[model samples]
Target: MQEHSHLDVGDADPPPGTARPGGRTARNREAVLDAALGLLAEHGYAATCVQDIATRSGVAASTIYRRWGNRDGVILDLAGTLVAEPVGALPDTGDLERDLTLLGRVILDVMSNPRDGVVQSTLVAAGVHSPTARRTLAQIINRRVEDTKIIAERAVERGDVPADTDAGKVINTLAAPIYHRWYILGEEPTDDELAGFARVAAHAARDALLT
Candidate 1:
């Protein structure tokens, strides 16, 4: 397992000699990022190397070096891409229970998917010690929390939750137990357990306890 560093997005650009090539260059860049993500999912950050990524991506080592500067650079870019992909996009079902249940299902699906789950775990492990990685993870999580806040806001509009509820905080609280189970206790929630969690969160929100 790769050692983790807490991350923060830094202001560093690709080093002095880098080129911003377009056209096929863009394609290569995408390929490289995909390759990096795949490797990170499989081998983790410490084990993943730039040369291996170049081989998997079919991009030249020189290109990766020129484009990203280093292995951490590639991983950071990969983290950005991974985190930007939306999760838990709930439908406007009008019923809060159904919507929240759907959201819980989505969360469970993503957290349990082999590829996504491994990639997430690997990234967090990398983030433990790396400030850049830590920042990247924080940014990704913040985006997710913001996205989840939409659900709370909608619930409020529908009179399913308190108007004064702090959406972000509520969402985070709702997710806390799930994350604790997975990350800390190394366990997955069963279907019933997942549903129960969602119910509790929804009721808590409805009762104005999530303020």
Candidate 2:
């Protein structure tokens, strides 16, 4: 069975010298990405190749190479797309706990999708010894940190969190457990587990900010 998976708003174009599709090229490129994702899901990163992607995408192997330098390039492009357009924004329910719960749910929804397994695997592989993968992961991490900062700032404005709180730290504490479970322990958090983490994280952040 093909592994299930999951992109970006403006600036949808791939890097320069790659595929610049207008009509047919666009369609074909999209097909290629879709196929690549499917193969990644089914075969994992190491097993996937240009030939496999080409066959799945119905594009020529040369075309795949011309667009994406190699498998790593394609995977990096996919990761970039995933981060550029996150699934949703952080909740702003005014209640910090409630907001965290909602955010946890959103994260769980994304991670639990079978398609995301490919990403998870790719990231794990990259962690071992791929500078390119490291760079891509770092970009995503930085973006997420910025996003958490925004959430913390919003909380401060609403008087839900203290003004002196280090938003980055708070976010790290909240996110660390989930990532550890998924990437390190090989355990995927269920919705219930995510909610629990959210609760604990919210409470901890609140205490740090307010107390």
Candidate 3:
């Protein structure tokens, strides 16, 4: 898979409050992330540890620690990597409703993937107690927010939404309920239902409520 341009943070310990960065004393970043995901898949997040990932990836325990700070950080990074589509990558169909429906599809892709859902929910539940994980998750979210805002900006240009529409709120309004149903209600919505969500969000945007 192609790495995102935003992730090329060189081989340094990424600054806190930044996007996912490559880090290591050697070429072990991918190895470590792969091992972490495999172990997470097999044993779940709570049961997996940094040492297990170190052993599985054949990187040193100290290196993993210095690179990611903890197991939660590793899990968060993996979650970011697994997003099927970056918010910015969602296609612009020249219509707000259609664009948002496509956004719903992206959300559906993540919600339907067991691995992706587990990793996301795990971080949401566990990152609160870990500074590193929390910070990394924030960086991930900030990146997505920046990406999604572009959609709203385009909508504004087309007069589909008001110029002052808050893109973050618009996206949150569009995405929150779908994710709520997934993580909170333990429900998997059909494509039609997902499209409904997009329609609702589109209506709200057109009505200037999400501004």
Candidate with top lDDT is: 1
- For model 1, residues 1-92, the per-residue Cα lDDT tens digits are 22322222233344455456444655676677777767776676678899999998899999899878998888777667657666644656
Model 1 TM-score on a 0 to 1 scale: 0.80
lDDT of 2 by residue, 164-203 (tens): 8777776666677877887779887877887787778677
lDDT of each: 0.72, 0.70, 0.71
Candidate 2 deviant stretches above 4 angstroms: 1-21, 148-150, 190-196, 209-211
Error (Å) of candidate 1 at residue 37 is 2.0
Ten-residue stretch with the least lDDT total in model 3? 1-10
Candidate 1: what lDDT?
0.72
TM-scores, one per candidate: 0.80, 0.80, 0.76
Error of 2 at 76 (Å): 1.2
Ranking by TM-score: 1, 2, 3
Error of 1 at 131 (Å): 2.2
Q: Which ten residues in a row have the lowest lDDT in candidate 2?
A: 1-10
Q: In candidate 3, what are the lDDT values of residues 1-211, reduced to their tens digit? A: 2121222213444456644444343347767777776676577777899999999888999978986788876776676564433543676889888887788777677655555555666776676787766666566666666677777779999987888888887777778888788867888877788788888888888888976
- Model 1: residues >4 Å from true position, as ranges? 1-21
